[model samples]
Target: MFNEEFHLEQPIRWGMVGGGRGSQIGYIHRCSAQRDHLFQFVAGAFDVDAARGKEFGQNIGIAADRCYPDYKTMFAEEAKREDGIQAVSIATPNFTHYEILKAALEAGLHAVCEKPLCFTAEQAEELLALAKKNNRIVGVTYGYTGAQMIHQARRMIEEGMLGEIRIINMQFAHGYHSAAVEANDQGTKWRVNPKTAGPSYVLGDVGTHALFLAETMVPNLHIEKLLCSRQSFVKSRAPLEDNAIVLIQYDNGAIGNLWASCVNAGSTHQQKIRVVGEKASIEWWDEHPNQIVFAEQGKPVQILDRGQGYLYQDDEAITCDRMGGGHAEGLFEAWANLYRRFATAMDRVNHGEQASDVMNEMWFPNITDGAQGVRFIENCVRSADEGSVWVEYK
Candidate 1:
């Protein structure tokens, strides 16, 4: 238990799993976790290959004795140490999320996991159950919602700046997998295999991010129904969809469409969102993440840029941190916000600080958010398989 201070004066001791020599997502998680110097990497399992994992541990300057061969061993042994990791970040493949997250929860450590959380709704539910049982914090890396512009957008909606949302438009596109790569690229091979990537590829990969973005931006946004169409542009390129479009109906009567694809040539990641309301409309593009355009029915378009509150103060922009207006902050910066929020919340809990009324007002993607992503994917797949019919998403 911590003293009355309960301050984050020092970095939180942390560990990693599955971010070895060439892990893409793992590297991003590591970068984000350390961005604010709020976390100290003290241990890790690192890889499935024992030798490679050990090498990574040593290269990263982790104490040899603290390194372990498998996540099971790492979690178990770390829990025994007085200076063990307070949190663990999992960067393994999609299929392994449930198992690794469960292990971390079981060992009584907070976790930050890469998105989609798990492959199935059942697995997601189990993780949530376990998280609750152990009183541990579980954060999913839905980094899009972490963007400062997004926070500003959400604040605007909450404040009725955009009166009565009528239409919500979003799109997520990627062209990295436009052509087959499994034959020559071992690193991306898992993305093309069902056994490794799970049932739905594009829908689960980028769709979840869009879904979370839509939900996060709107106040109490609820999907009433959905209609989806999916196609395997490259039959052998990936086990599941390479492209899809989902039409969503919100309970508030606002309608929207979400287009996601991995085979759109030249589209590295062009995720964009636009919300049209009775009084005004707001649009934000991932490519131009630092700014948001707002326009009322008879008003001129207003462009909002990012900046820290201390220097260039804009109430909405203050929610989003920035070195300055022109100094760009992208994926890693957004992820840093998620990691910081998770650490702060967990830090409070670990100090025997009980959950307060203020804590309930806190924001960060958690196990519940993870489960909702799974729900969005499963429902979309079902709607697509059943001939793109209207599937109730209640």
Candidate 2:
């Protein structure tokens, strides 16, 4: 069970670079970071419009002076303060991520950044190197991996319950943008624009989330090669796909497929993953995140509910259960879990402990994972653009 009383001696002073007014992503970031009283939201460059950004920041209880006109200004000004921000969250569009994150790290601040960490794998590598040199924590919000059931799956797989994992299927297909909604929606507009959203749309947007889930569950598998085919179903979003399929060959001889689409008409966030092994298989759906379907060969299927005794008793998994079985805990809890880990990581680093050392004690999606996601996007795009031929994974 999660301990509500758990807190750092002094909450990490946190700020934001985006996720201003009317931004659902911003709200989630704030809620999750402050949920367990682990972070203190003290500043932000909330929007492109300085006036509106300041207004929004003030409305949310931030001091007007702390909400600067832009991220650079915010970082520069905050550094002179006696109580400067030690960490920041970048909630901006895809293109701004690399620059803002770079600035944050150079400013000696820990960061929690949105996915598709940068436009290219090269950029991701640079960020990784910069993070290491600065000894800063770069937490990528692969939010779903923080779910308790995910850890449960990891434990089960580690225990060889899913013997010799062979096949993995992952998808995060949804129907929200089936008909070119970006025509009027600002949020959707930036996402489809290659300048703002990066190389592939659905691939980096939702595909990485599913990929990370599989990675978390079966940590030993490594992609050796992959073939990808992508389409911009709503023609106008050209060069940036609205749907994509990736077929992967793992070094361990495991085969996997990923389907990421926003055109799965009539579907509502159909994010799911199914892992098959020689002995049995396990499946999880985000819609019903609290349960896992366990099917052993030649036996009746079983449903593994969260927080149950039958589940693994590992400290990481058990402690993630915010509420006992029979209660509901969704994405908010999941994001908060990651935030808690991020705070701990930042705190440890601040106290002269190494980031790698902290990781050895607790798991959180860090810079390395973010770099891998970016590399995955790069590989998928490369394969798709070249007539969808099988390409050796770099």
Candidate 3:
């Protein structure tokens, strides 16, 4: 058994590879890590650009001495410290994930990287092996998995409260289309650049969240085949696809549809998920993230709050119930919660102690999920390129 005593004294020391000034995702990652207070960021190489790296460090209150100019500097300097960073959060763009992550793991540091995991499946495989060989922990942030109420929804389904699941209808669309891809100069910059963004456009970014949610709630779920279509509605945008639609089938005969577009107007993150089961149906959405709407046959609709007195079979479900109702928790908090879990896992592994419930449930996304996500993006692009024929997932 792991010693609770050991876990308490040693907090996870952390650093950052990206997420410099004005970076949306990096800000989210920092807020999330701070929320739990389980991980203490001791150092960072916040930006790939030197000036921005220093300025970002100053802006975030990260000390100059600990804020290095590049990831290489951060790794080399910190690894020499007796109090070096135990982990590094990679908030860089998609393409940078693999190399930065590989270095971190090799240096005996754990990693909490933002998603789409890696740019390719092969990189994902190699990283997984490196992590195993080093006995290091890695987590990919699939935001929906950490959302408070999503846990309750997953638990209800797992406990058979919703009966055998049949189909999932998940739709997430936003009006950021033009704002994201057309905000020329700096607007459509890195995100639309193929060199930085790696592959598809809006779908690779937001669509992954939709896929992670569906995959998490359903049991024995393996994405069997997928049919996808892409669109460059703006036509002349550089770097990535601006819009896309994907059809997915799970191994157990369940089907799902996902659509993402950056050209669509007047939409403000309109997202919802509906799961139809033999016993009942449940619905949840980002707009009303606080509750999951559960409806059973011939019964009034029920709204379940976070952290209420509910029995949830999954660790994530229990996490939701513990947080309770009326306390609004969103993206940043969920991200923080994942970091807290990462701290727990790191403490277990670093101290050479036995694992706990958090480790057992594998609450955070790992190497396989990362690999799967890369394949997912590749297939989506391939299907779109090949005239939208269904593509098989390897």
Candidate 4:
């Protein structure tokens, strides 16, 4: 059991390994961490170029001495300080996750890293075991799972409010790469490059978020078999797939379909998931994140709004904002919620305690969830490469 009396006297000190100037994802990570008021950025290694890294750090108000040229130096020097960072955020590209994460854990610092834990399932599993050995908290940020309504859906499914889940339909579509930005833009070039983004670029980048959301909401279902097809619309601009589709069979006898496309001209940053059950069904979309369209077998569809008063499940209300009801709190708030919750758990672990059942179920996205995501990416690629032959999900 964890101590309720444990006091967090100060905001946890945190550092960053990436997200220097002109990096959109880096800005998002920094803003989200600050929004929660649970973390204070103290140090950083912001870019691959040492001069650029120092300049970026200085501009962001990180002291000249603490601004490091590389992640290795940041972790080492910070670990030596008495008031060193307790946690570090890895906002770098997909391929850099493994070494940075391992460094943080080995240095006795907690981590809140971006999704798709690593390039391979073996690396993901190794990182998970290392975190356990060090007794540290490792959080993978699945931003969409931070949404309040998503939690409500998870609770409803767990409580059997929606009978037995029968089908799942998920899609994440974007228009940014519809015309191939990689051909001209150097910043986004890594996304289409196998060396930086790993195999299955579309799936590994944005598609994995959809996979994690389904895994989080439908906890009882395990993927049994998968058949996938991946396509590259402009082969000259990008070698990796920009569009992909997947068909999944679950161990619990449910079926699922997933589609991811970067070439959808109008669907910019749109993501949605629909889970159907024997008695009722629920659907949610990021575009209109404040509501859930729920339907019963014979009853009319109910437009469920997110607020403390509108929730039947108490756990959902706990995630609601102080001044909610009509005011929209979307992406940044949701992401911050994940950070705050992760920090809370890290605080517990540092104080010599165990995370309660509620924390694991409702708050944290632990190592196991991240490992499964890596496995999903690996399995999906294998299935596609084998001529869409059904492959058993390991």
Index of the highest-lDDT prediction: 2
List the global CA lDDT of all models: 0.81, 0.93, 0.76, 0.82
- Model 4 gets an lDDT of 0.82
Ranking by TM-score: 2, 4, 1, 3
Order of the predicted models by lDDT, top scorer first: 2, 4, 1, 3
Q: Write the per-residue lDDT of candidate 1 for residues 66-101, one digit (tens) a residue.
A: 778999999888888888888999988888988888
* TM-scores for all predictions: 0.93, 0.99, 0.91, 0.94
Per-residue lDDT of 226-316 in model 4, one digit per residue for the tens? 9999998978544578999999999989999999888889876778999999999989898887778888889988987777565654573
User: Which of the predicted structures, 1 or 3, would earn the higher lDDT when compared with the native?
Assistant: 1
Better of 2 and 3 by TM-score: 2
Give the number of the best model, judged by TM-score: 2
lDDT of 1 at 281: 90
- Stretches of model 1 off by over 4 angstroms after superposition: 1-10, 237-239, 308-317, 320-322, 354-359
Off by over 4 Å in 2: none
Residues forming the 10-long window of minimal summed lDDT in candidate 4: 1-10
